[model samples]
Target: MDDQRRIFLATASRLGALAALTSASATGRAQNRDGGHAYPFSLGVASGSPLPDAVIIWTRILHDPLNAAATPRLAFSVRWEMAEDEQFRRIVAKGAASAAPELAHSVHVDVTGLRPDRWYWYRFMLGDAVSPVGRTRTVPAASGMPKQLKLAVASCQHWEFGTYAAHRHIAAAAPDLVAFLGDYIYEWGPYQLRHPKSAVRASESFTLADYRARYAQYKTDANLQAAHHAAPWIVTWDDHEVANDYGNEQDERLDPRFLQRRAAAYQAFYEHMPLRLTPRDFAHLRIYQRYDWGKLARFHVLDDRQYRADLACPPPGRGGSNSVQPRTCPALTDLGRGMLGREQEQWLAQGLSSSPARWNILAQQTLMAQNSQLPVVKEGDGRFWTDGWDGYPAARRKLMDTLHTSRASNPLVLSGDVHSFFACELARNPSRPASPDNPLLATEFCGTSITSPSRPQTRTEQYVSMNHGIKYGRSDKRGYMLLTITPSDTSAHFLVLDNVHDDASPIARAAAFVVRDGRAGPVRA
Candidate 1:
């Protein structure tokens, strides 16, 4: 095997042993596509970005490359079926697609003509062998407004983090949709010890192959695939997908000479994920888009790193992963400042105004809160604005104002990154003195990292006490947040995972929060 492929496989095998020690995600069965085991399912089929009649189904043809070194690109004629019953005796849609070697033998068949807002089960068959069964569904078609919407917003699932305990818990709950806000993969040194993989992928992935190989390793995780198999996902990236704290058109780890890695990462991101392939390639990368869930929600997904200014503090630094909570100050106003550039902002503003969706959801990867430590602590208290909206105060204010002026029926911001859980009320005019009338224009729920370590709760509580604007905070848990929305009310199900490495983890509680329509703020339940 080539060095790259060997590393990827060896890493999975090595970590597989340790990963079993703590992860509930690995509990399904000793079935992997590696061929040494029964290899029960082909990473189970998944569908995402649902439309009235179409949902994209994805699966990879896994073969024993070790037995046939030349067959790294596994190929097979695969058949998929979506049915109203567990048995295909009552099939709704069926089709044939070839998982060709050029695409790493992965299949992305966009299936159309299915009922909307209804349940369906699906699976893939390769020859006489069938894959694991998974369930997925579409949203209400346009003009239809259903009552409740359940979405699970998650991010930062590092591979070695004890078996995707968070993913298993999410699957058990069976949310309607999963919004993966970012940090889907960490592309750096010092990967968490919890990662089951033996050694990490290249620390600086700058080529299409590097990115693809990285994703292949991540997708091999049973817990991750289960989450995908269980429900369609709404994914948006925050650093780590490409590189840490990366801003638009910049490199976090690459030297000036190796910037071409960006194209590599972008293209690989496309090939591995369930995302569709297009003939067009912007320097060999594909990302950035939005999705709407009927009138109940209109999700405006943003790529924070695609177009951002580098972090300002500790000068001459690339923004990513540096000081997950960076330094703050004058650098916050650099003219190059921007979280979401002009075009994106305008598009979002336009979408917010034109769309009739009752809820305007900005699904992003950073904190929108303007927090500056009072009686300022050390040089970098992780408050530096360069890494997030704080880096561009003017731009953040504009976005906040647009939501305020548009009077979006209910504006809610869901984000990942910052590695903790935060619930806050956004003030269009935070500058205004605290008053009942200084109405909060929007609500923000920052989900904790899916598996990333949060700063200890003790320190976080101390910081929260000092920073009043931060309504609540918790930094020492490896879990995700669940969001339940209704036309008249939106509540967050802050689902907590007991142990990331445990074989049978339990979800602690569904900490609830409610936002009354038009009131524009979340109240603790």
Candidate 2:
């Protein structure tokens, strides 16, 4: 036997009687008659970070997902296989990874040496238990130009509010990639508030175990799992992943122990994701990165939560977001304040300046276009929401300047977390309508949350009317955005669920917009 296979066998032998009880059929599906242990792959399998010749496939060996203490302390050998076909007959790559209890027994296998721009099926095995098979594909080679790209963008799934019917539909669409723009799991839960009989946790997650259990509970949802299994995902976090409206090291409550809580949450996030980088000290995780879809598109996925300044002019003793009149709040105009921090801002500028792709996609959390609560007919009439881009006007202006000066080709910003679908023309000053002097610089399609509730539709209408650049806004529905990108143009479809309370709810296109090549704004399609 080869050294790798021999080593894998030696490690598998450590499972002792359990490994001996393992058996498989012709398709490599584990058939374990062993009744001594609970199933290990209850959380399902996923793949992400698709490079030209590599993708990260992940799974966690959880006997009792709700309780991290149930996992044994010993290291376990996990076997993974990738094939060109659903059946294992054409296995292209196979490897073994060690799932230690330190990372909650999670396995992240960065499989490489595969052909680019091709679909593959992968699964994980831990002794007698086998994970669900997942479908993934690598991006086209860096220099190669592809004709089209289909992408599904989604975010803000609060487990208690509604069902993940949107994710179910996303899986059905089978987009080339899934970009999760954050709030994968809310930091707190009152299970009885919405779904009275639900078994999810009823408190906030503050420790490592709590965070892990929360993630486990969310993963139990089959629709979300199906979405993960359908395509390679690119993910970034928003506030809810740690605490609602949290910025930098401060939570809404301004607890002195907030950083410790954040560390636990960050570690849990890393453990559950199929990411390329590992967290440093469980406190800092550099999630902002770039991905190229051949020469067709360049995705600049960003992290806006970790390094942002705290919400300007928060209520006394509170550190989270609030609504404030920019004219009255002097701190709102701080030129030094930034939403993406200094380093990330520079990196983004550099990327935008150097990218040669036909489309430049800024996949981020929350809306980028300015949305004032009141009409901006005069200087002091506008009321801005402190949680989004309006909170950092200087930074937003800087980003818009970069897009303009860099002359980034067909710049498109995809955002979420507001729980509303918004189509807007990004301009130097979004308060006023686009014109010859202050022209549109890019297009933005901010999708609604998967299940999170939104403000009333009437209020959304008012905001749309007040924000001249916003071509469309809808807060009544909950869903995701589907993007079809080509050399000539990019189309966005706002797909909404009829009933988020029902897991099998039907979905429909609520709106559609198209941005043609070399154009700066989206027009109704």
Candidate 3:
């Protein structure tokens, strides 16, 4: 059946749509009864660097990958084994856990007391058969620095856009951690696909089940799974995970209440992610968190939604995305007009001011530098852009000022979103600089999207030209970025995928940037 037809049928019967998720076939049980095989393992194991020492290991138990009659609801004791050597000659940590079908049989065990600044291999076991062996590592103790650190970032991966060829490239780089900047899944319409048959979106995800199904589908992709199995991943969410342009308390569309949708999104995000759940009573918050990667760098991963005020628009739109009377929005400078609520801001500020790490990296989303407003659009964009930090001038300024005054060493802002890629020297005022020596305290590198379609150089040139702050830009490609930080200089290379249209495609280097130590900005080389 076609994608649109699938949607028409699924929406026609909501309960039937759900029943299919739990459907089982008879061929599955017969093989299981007679085959006398070991347990089945499908979802491979993964780890996250939400903290040092502690690593979250995850797996999903399955009855069988080939059997249709096998139920996905089987509860099983998922066992984990971590070894020091790739040969498994020396085992370090061993643990056991259980996941019932009610929870999708997914398990996450936070393993502690492992060696830091070290590489480890792990596998999930059921009975006789074992899962695909995955590799993971822990951040060294604070004040400990690796001679080098390799990390990759990416966002906006719509299955319909193309294959995860970028993921294949990331796996080859052999990064210590994959810092996923969000939009791991796109809630796109099925009609958006040019290769319609490959990607089929039958339902709009709103409830927890829908969200989980979305994650499960993405998890099934070979490239995405390969990357996850290749290294521990650090993840955060962006608007598309819920709805596009849905920021703070505002929803651009009139379809769903922001908070209700947020709760569902968060629950599903945590369940599929390698995140250690922080059990809360009734209140829900997933906006802010920090990670210390040894003493080399401290990552302050933040949420710019939940607490943001309404948007600033000269004219209003259909929903709340970016509309005027956004004055209908509260005062953005209202101290309460927080993108990061007071509590999160305070936490971030304290972390920045007191961080002893050599590099304090702000691993967040959105373009931090100043973006052009008008005539520039006519020149290059062919359309005006006001979706991200550009829409919230006040919030952007506050964060910039905080960075300018802080003493953190080599403070660099790593961001995504804008679909397009932007590398800029973030100044107190990009249109004009106040001081040369203190050209402004930091640098901002905005990576491009995973599979989201972006404008070409023809469309982005004029915008970059008009916007004095932007040093470089490209919206034509879908790929990820490899940020290599060393004691001498922090270098970032945009790892562009040769093509995502083909499944077997390989990636190649597109560009590179080196922000030397003591240098306040990034210079393309």
Worst 10 contiguous positions by lDDT, candidate 3: 18-27
- Return the TM-score for each candidate structure: 0.84, 0.92, 0.85
Which ranges in model 1 have alpha carbons more than 4 Å from their true place?
A: 1-42, 64-75, 188-206, 276-279, 282-286, 317-329, 374-385, 429-438
Model 3 clash pairs?
25-69, 143-295, 248-305, 252-321, 325-328, 326-329
Off by over 4 Å in 2: 1-31, 190-201
**What would the per-residue lDDT of candidate 3 be over residues 21-132, giving only the tens digit for each residue?**
2222111331223367523554345788545576888876655433312545567787888887656889999988887665567788888888777777788877665666
Q: Cα miss at 107, model 3 (Å)?
A: 1.2
Q: Which residue pairs does candidate 2 place in steric collision?
A: none
What CA root-mean-square deviation does each model show from the true structure?
7.6, 7.1, 8.9
Residue-by-residue lDDT tens digits, candidate 1, 323-364 = 224333555555566767667777888888887888889999
The candidate with the higher TM-score, 2 or 3, is: 2
The best candidate by TM-score is: 2
